[model samples]
Target: MSPERYARINQMLDNRQTDLTLCLDTVHKTQNIAAVIRTADAVGIHQIHAVWPDAEMRVSGNTASGSQQWVKTLQYSSMSEAAKQFNLQGMQVLATNFSDKAVDFRDIDYTKPTVVIMGNERDGVSDEGLAIADQHIIIPMLGMVQSLNVSVASALIMYEAQRQREQAGMYGTRQLDEAYCQKMLFEQGHPIYAKACRRKNIPYPSIDAQGQIEANATWWQRMREPDPNADEA
Candidate 1:
C-alpha cells in the first residue's frame, strides 16, 4: 500500500465503533441492504447483523456496493439467534416497531452498546423480534406516511448513535483490537495479495506500521506456488 493509503485505512480503523451495530430482521430488499451498509460505513460502524432465512436472498445480497466489503455482515438463521447474540454481548436490543408503548428513537441513549433491529420492508419486525428486544423504538413521522424506508430509518438511528457517541468521546481513541487492526490493514490495504492469500489458503502475513507485508522469503515463495488443497476443493 502507498503511504497515503496506509494512513487513510489506519485512520478509519482508529475511528471504528466496535460496539454500535444494527440488525436486519429478514430485510430482503437488496437496495435497502446496500444503502444501509453504505450509511454504516459512513458512520464508522465496522459490522452489522442480518437474518437471512432465504437461500436465494443470501447469495444476491452479497452483491451490494463496495461498502459491503467494508462493513462485515454477520448472518443468522433466525431472529431468536440474533437476540441471543445481543444478550451475550450485553447489547441493548432496540426493535423498530410502532406500538402504544414504543418510545421515540431519539429518546434512547445510544452511547451504550446497542443493536437496533430494523424490520423487513413488507412484513416489518417479526413477532419474536419484538418480543426479544429490550426496547421498542420508532421514528416520529409528521405526515400521513407512518414510517420511512428501512435503509433510511437505519441511517437515522445510526447517526443518532454516532452523535451521542461523539459527544461522549467514544471515537476519541482507537477501540478496535491491535491484531484486528493489523489484519484489516493488510486485507483492505493490499487487495491483490490478500486475494492470493485466500485463493492459496496461505496464512495472512503480519503488517508493519507502514502497512507493508512482513513475511520472509519462504512465505513469498509459497505465494507463487499453486495451492496443494485446490484439488481437494
Candidate 2:
C-alpha cells in the first residue's frame, strides 16, 4: 500500500472512531486475550495495553493470529507505568469493578482518549490497578447473572464506546496522528522490508509497501554496474 492508500484506509477508519483503548490487568487466559484483541481491532481501537508481571506475559502466534501485528500491544511490568504513560498522553483510565461507587459503563464519556481496564477473570482488577484508575465503571446486569466473561464484557464496553464516539462525531474526523499512522502502515504493509531497514540501520523511504524495490538481478546490476561477461544475452 502507498501512503495515499494508507491515508485512504485511515480515512475510512477515522469514520468509525479510533482513540478508545483496552488495558488488560493480569488476564491469564490466552483465549480471552485473543478474543479481546480481536474485538479491540474490530472496534477500531488503536492500541491495547497488557499489564502483567514480566514473567506472565505470553502470546503464541496461534493465539494472537497476527492480530498483535495489526494492533499495537504494549506489555508493562506494572500498572503504574502503563497508567502514567496513558495519563501523560491525556487518556482517562476507567477501571471496571463492582464497587458501590462505580458508574454505569454507558454513562462515561468515550469520545476522548480512554483506557478501559479489565482485570483477571478469577480475581478482577488488582488493588494497584484500581488505585491508578481515574474512575470505575460497571456493566449493569439483572438476569440472574452477576457478571459476564471478561472477553464478553470487554466487547460490550468497546461497542458502547464506539457508539458514543460515533454519535459525537469523534469518528468523523482523522484522529490518528499523521506520523504515527505512517509508521504503523509502513510496518504493516512491509514487514520484511521494514525489518531489513531497521536491522541495516537504513533510513526508510517515504514510499509505501507496494513501491518497495525488489532486489533482483536487474537491481544488483544497477547497483554494481554489470560486466559484459555477466550478461547471458
Candidate 3:
C-alpha cells in the first residue's frame, strides 16, 4: 500500500461508528440497496445487515460508485436471525413503519447502540421485522406522500443518529478497539498478503511506517512455511 492509501484507510477506520448499524428486510432493488450503502458510509456507519433470504443483495456499479467497498454489508437468511444477533450485542432495534404505537424518528435516544431497520419499499416493515423491533419510528409526512423512500428514510435516520452521537462526543475520538483497527487496516489495505497469512496460519506481517512490507526478512520466510495438518490433495 502507498503511504497516502494507508493514511486514508487509517483515518476512516479511526472515525468509524462501531455502535451504529443499519438493517434492511427483503429490499431486493439493487439501486435502493446501493443508495442505502452510500448514505451509511457518509454517516460513518461501518457495518450494515441486510436480509434478502431468496437472493443475494445486489447493487449496481453506477449506484454504488465504490461506496460498497468502504462499508461492510452482512447478509442474513432471516430477519429473526439478524435481530437475535443485534439483540445479543445490546443494540436497540428500531423499525420504520406506520403504526398506532410508532413515534417520531427524532424523539428516540439515538446515542445508544442502535440498529435502524428498513423494510420493503412498497409493503413497509413486515410483521416479523416489527415484532423483533424494540420500537417503531416514523418519519413525519408533511406533503402528499405518506412516507419517504427507503433510502431517503435511511439517510434521515442515520444523520439523526450521527447528530445525537456527535452531541455526546462520540466522534471526538476513536471508538474502535486497537486490535480491530489493526485487523481492518491489514485486511482492507493489504488484502492479498492478509489472505496469505490466514492461509498459512501465521500472524499478519507488520507493515512499515510507509505501509510497505519487509519482503526479504527471516520471520517472513518462516511464515511462508506450509502447514502439515495432513489435508493433502
Candidate 4:
C-alpha cells in the first residue's frame, strides 16, 4: 500500500466506534440499504446487523458508492437472533417506531453502547424487534406526512448519535480492539493476501507500520503445514 493509503487506513481504524452499530429489520430496498450503509460509515459505525429473513441482503454499488467495500454488514436469519447478540453485548437496542410509549430520538443518551434499529420500508419495526428493543424512539414530524423516509430518518438519528459520542470524547481516541484492527488493516490493505490466509485457516500475517503485510515464504509454508493429529479421512 502507498504511504498515503496506509495513513488513511490507520486514521479510520483509530476513529472507528466499537460500541455503536445499526440494525435493519427486514428492510429490502436496495437504495435505502445503500444510503444507510453510507451514513453509518460517515458516522464511524463499523458494523451493521441486518435481519432480512425473506430476502437476500444486497447493497447497491451506485448508492453506496465505495462504502459497501469499507463497512461490514452482517446478515441474520431472524431479528430475535440479532437482538439477542446485541443485548448480550450490553447494547441499548432502540427501535425506530412511532408509538404512544416511544421517546424522542434526541432524548436518548447515545454516548452509551447503542444499537439503533431501522425498520422495514413499509411496515416499520417488526413486532419481534419492538419486543426486543430496550426503548422505542421517534423523530418528531411537523408536516402532514407522518414520518420520514427510512434512509432519511436513519441519517438524522445516526448523526445525533455521532454528536453525543463526540461530545463525550469517544471520537478523540482509538476505540476498536487492537486484534480486530490488525485484521481489518490486513483485509483493507492487502485483500488477496488476507484471503489466502483465511483460505488456509491461518491467522493473518502482521501488518507493518506502513500498512504493508509482513508475509513471507515461511509464513505460507507454516500455513500449509498439515495438522499432526489429523485422523485418516
Candidate 5:
C-alpha cells in the first residue's frame, strides 16, 4: 500500500473499537452473510462470529467486495461455543427476536461491549442462541411485511451502533489500544512481506507512518536493488 493509504488506515484503526461484534447463527445464504460482513466492516466492527453446522459457508468475491479481509471472520460449529467464548471475554450477547422480554432496539446501550446476534434467514435465531443472550431486541415494524431481510436487519443494527458510538465518542481516539494499532498498521502497509514472514515464523520489518522501513533497512534496500547476476546488454 502507498504511504498515504497506510496513514489513512492507521487513522481508521485508531478509531476502531473492539468492544462491539456481530454474531450470525446458522445463516445459510451466502449473499446475506456477505452483505452482513460488508456492513460490519463499514461500521468498524472488530470481529464477526459465524456459527454453521458444517463448513459450507462461502462468500463470493463480488458479494464480499474485500470487506472480509478487513473484518476478522471467525467460524464455529455451535452457537453455544461461540456464545461461551464471547461471554468468557465479558461481552454481552444480545439476540434479535420477538419475545415478551424483547426491548426496543433504540433503547439498548451500545457503549458496552456487545455482540449483536442475528438468526437464520427463515427460522430466526436458534433456541439455544436465544437462551444465552443477555437480552433480546426487536426493531418495531409497522409495515405489512413484518420482517426485514437478515442482511438489512444486521445493517440497521450495526449502523445504529455506529451512530450511538459516534455520539458517545466511542469512535474517537483510543478506539484500538496502542499495541494493536501498531500491529495492524504494519500488516496493512506490507501485506505480502507480512505473509512471507508469517509463513517462515519471522517477524515482519516495521514501517513508520510514511511507509519507510524501520527494522533491517539494509536488507530491504539490498532486495530492491537490481540483480547484477542477470545478463544485460
Candidate 6:
C-alpha cells in the first residue's frame, strides 16, 4: 500500500463507531443490501448484523465488495437469535415499524449504543422482532406514501444516528480493538497478499507504519514458495 493509502485507511479506522450497528431482518434484495452496507460504512459503522435463513437472500461476494471489505456483516440463522445477541451486548434495539405506538424515528436517542433493525422489503418486521425490540420507530412522511424503501429508510436512520453521534463527539477517536484494527489495515492495505494468506492458510504478518508487510523470514519464504497443490482432482 502507498503511504497515502495507509493514512486514509488509518483515518477511517479512527472514526469507526463500534457501538452503533444495524440489523437486517431478511432484507433480501441485493441492491438494498449493498446500499445499506455502503451507508453503514459512510457513517463509520464497522459492523452490522443480518438474519437471512435463505442462503440466496444473503449478501453475495460481488455485492458492494468495497463496502463489504470494511464492514463486517455477522449473519444469524434466525431473527430471535440475533435479537438475543443484541440484548446480551446491551444495545437499545429499535425496530422500524408502522404502528400506532411507533415514535418518530428522529425522537429516539441515537447517541446510545444502539442497533436499528430494518425489516424485510415486503413483510416488514417479523412478530418475533417486534416483540423483542425495545421500541418501534417510524420516519414521518408528509405525502401519501407511508413507508420508504428498506435501503432508503436504513440510510436515513443511519445518518440520524451519525448526526447524534457527531454532536456527542463520538467520532475521530478509535474504539475498535487494536488487533482488529491491525487486521483490517493489513487486509485492506495489502489485498493481494491478504488473499494469498487466506488461500494458503498462512498467518497474517504485521503491517508496518508505511503499510508494508512486516513478516519474519519464515513468512517471506512461504510467500516465495508457490502453492504446490495449485491444481488437483
* Runs with alpha carbons beyond 4 Å of true place in candidate 1: 56-63, 226-233
Give one digit per residue, the lDDT tens place, for model 6 in 74-153: 99989888978887889999999988889999999988889988999999988878988889999999999988999999
Clash pairs detected, candidate 3: none
Predictions: Cα RMSD each:
2.6, 5.8, 4.1, 4.8, 4.0, 1.7
lDDT of 3 by residue, 1-233 (tens): 87788998777876789779998988887888999999998889988999888987777767898888778899999998898889888999999988999999999999889998899888988889999998999999989989888988999999999898888888747877777766777777788878777767767665566767645676577666675543889
Best by the TM-score measure: 6
Model 5 alpha-carbon drift over 4 Å, by segment: 177-180, 195-202, 217-233
- What is the Cα root-mean-square deviation between model 5 and the actual structure? 4.0
Local accuracy of candidate 2 as per-residue lDDT tens digits, 116-229? 899999999999889888899999998998889999999999999888876876765766776665666556656666765665554444444454443556433444443434
Ranking by lDDT: 6, 1, 4, 3, 5, 2
Q: What is the TM-score of each candidate against the true structure?
A: 0.92, 0.78, 0.83, 0.86, 0.86, 0.94
Error of 1 at 84 (Å): 1.1
- For residues 11-71, write the lDDT of model 1, one tens digit per residue: 8888899889999989987888888988999999989999888753442445565887678
Error of 3 at 95 (Å): 0.8
lDDT (tens digit, per residue) of candidate 5 on 1-233: 78687878876686676889988999989899999989888888877989998876788878999887778788899987897789787988899999999998989999889998999998999998999999999999998887899999999999898999999987757666666666777777777767655555555565675765577766566555555554686
The lDDT, on a scale of 0 to 1, for candidate 4 is 0.87
Q: Candidate 2 has what TM-score?
A: 0.78
Question: lDDT for each of the candidates?
Answer: 0.88, 0.77, 0.84, 0.87, 0.83, 0.90
Which has the greatest lDDT? Answer: 6
The TM-score of candidate 6 is: 0.94
Compute the lDDT of residue 198 as modeled in candidate 5.
59
